[model samples]
Target: MATEYAFDIASDLKTVQALELLSRHISGLTLTWNGKNRDYLVGSTINISVSEQLRSWQETILEGFGFTPTLSVGFRFHNNTDFDAFSEIMFQATMLLLEHAEDAVLLFNYEIIVLQRLGGKLVFNAGYQMWDDDWLKSRLSLPFERRPLPSPLL
Candidate 1:
């Protein structure tokens, strides 16, 4: 069974600056053309299988000054197989982002769902407890807050 967890990290820098910081600190970070919209872009870090779409208010004061950077990232891992490896990737990526930002917020995006195979069918169970011991928490000494995902899961 596979489970997915998502989170957001907002930074105090502009979109360009945040991208630059991530490019410098994050390994295997790449810019991919957004196939749906040519003008838009997506960023991915190979280590954790995390992808981010950064956006800011369209007002010139915000986009021009590069003062507001909102980043949305997610991780999908198999509960029975890839949890530890992917979770570790998530931790490392989070650490790198926070290190380069002046301010950041990590928002819990969805109920951690544990899936199990039952007679060839998959069942979903709330697994939020799994998050309490997540390695990302262990890496950050500062207190962090959790908030709902920006959008509900499908």
Candidate 2:
């Protein structure tokens, strides 16, 4: 059976900066909607939805990106076997936003929602967290070496 899950992130990074970071880091995976290629440039919005159902399992992926000086990236994945993969991707994206806005004291907020059917009824579990620069830095592994450098020699 397919499950519904979503990750919503809010950060101070500009749309262009966020988009650039995602485009660079998440190149390995193709984020398309319904298996169709879509243009997601700076200042542009992206919304993709795809679904597949087979026998005992159904899978769906919905991803959207919006730019408004502050960037919002939402990812919805159904029946995901592992959450680590999702966290890894979000971590990378967050790190990129932080790197771009160095001097700015930024805030980060994220929410995860999972929906499941129980007893023939739909149920959802949702949680959200907000953190400042200090807390985020302390809780997250944002090492200097992991950050992208303009010059490799640096």
- Tell me each candidate's TM-score: 0.41, 0.35
Clashes (candidate 1): 1
Q: Write the per-residue lDDT of candidate 1 for residues 75-104, one digit (tens) a residue.
A: 555344555555555555556666544433
lDDT of 1: 0.40
- Output the worst ten-in-a-row residue range by lDDT, candidate 2: 145-154
For model 2, how does the per-residue alpha-carbon lDDT over 1-154 read when each residue is reduced to its tens digit?
Answer: 3322222223355444455556767544443323332323221122212122122221111121111122234443324345455444444454554444422111121223222121223222222232234544565553321121121111
Runs of candidate 2 exceeding 4 Å displacement:
1-17, 31-69, 102-154
Instruction: Name the weakest run of 10 consecutive residues (lDDT summed) in model 1.
Output: 115-124
RMSD of model 2 against the true structure: 16.4
Full-model lDDT for every candidate: 0.40, 0.32
Residue 123 alpha-carbon offset, candidate 2, angstroms: 30
